[model samples]
Target: MKTNTTTVNGIDTQALLGAIEAIRNNPAEAQSKWHVTSHWKGGTRSETKVKSSQLGNQTIAKDFTIGIDEPLELCGTNQFANPQEYLMAALNACMIVGYTALTALEGIELEELRIETEGEIDIQGFLGLDPSVKPGYDHLRYTVHLKGDGTPEQFERIHRTVMATSPNYFNVANAVPLKSKLVLESPATV
Candidate 1:
């Protein structure tokens, strides 16, 4: 039998169907692992690079990098996006992906989709101005403006799905465990 193919919101429905078939053929292939490495520059700046990730029994390579820094008021050169800004960007970007894919999978046609996010943080915690202040965003807010052919109920369903499945949203919404190990560096060899 021939497979039916269609495009929704610029995504190929057949491609998603193919992926579903692949995952069904070997469920283990659906599990993925991602890795990123970072190198600290100077004065609260760093560069993170992603080259490859493990996809089941295979590894895929790509060229991607991001430069991170704080604003001048935070004692940085303001050369690039700060870590906190990246955090917000991650959340918004992930939501965009999730929303678009989910909407397309549901056969919803979208005209426009925009997301804006902001976070509130008290610097006193990082600067040691007050011991009681937490060193992270106290609150974060996001507004998504969507224009599409789908009904409001469908949009609401998509919203709920995005919130539940978006990886970055899950990361920020819940307290995830972090394990850090400090490795003292030996003297660099010439």
Candidate 2:
């Protein structure tokens, strides 16, 4: 049997439209906050757990654990992806969502889409060997390979849309204010 569900590029356009309308009608519903915790395992190894999120005054439970490690040269076991990889992954995932949604909204079907990202960092600052060195990545360069029935102009438009709209894209391209606090615990606290 054939269904009348409206889908484009595997996205439910009908539901998407409905959600967009809902968010427009209730702007507070569009607000969300993600929460996670990272714990150091040992010597350059750490793991993060995504436990919950707040959306429009409602708590949403999320279950996800991600392992992180560094290369042997950096003093880690090379067990899992490093933080840099995760950052790029988040950026790529956000872009994927933007491309999928925008393309679907514009009635474009996608056959293939891939984004490759690379960045360079200086270890001197991390190791505290140099006072003038910056610890983070200098910059990240990425290439998107896309193939579909859309015109070159359409693809370029989507690319621009993703760059403008992707949350992780914006986060990485611009500096975001981070408010952090330190809590000291004694051995008997646990």
The whole-model C-alpha lDDT of candidate 1 against the native structure comes to 0.88
Candidate 2: residue 89 Cα off by (Å): 0.8
Model 1 TM-score (2 dp): 0.91
Kindly report which residue pairs in candidate 2 clash with one another.
none
For model 2, residues 162-183, the per-residue Cα lDDT tens digits are: 9998999999999999998989
Residue 122 alpha-carbon offset, candidate 2, angstroms: 1.6
Assess each prediction's global lDDT (C-alpha) against the native.
0.88, 0.90
For each candidate in turn, the TM-score is 0.91, 0.92
Candidate 2 residue 77 C-alpha distance from true site, Å = 0.9
Where model 1 places Cα greater than 4 Å from the true spot, the runs are 1-5
- lDDT per residue (tens digit) for residues 1-190 in model 1: 1133377877787797788899999999888898899999988899999999887789998899999999898899999999888998989999998888888888888889999998777889988889999988877999999998889999999999999989899999999999999999999999
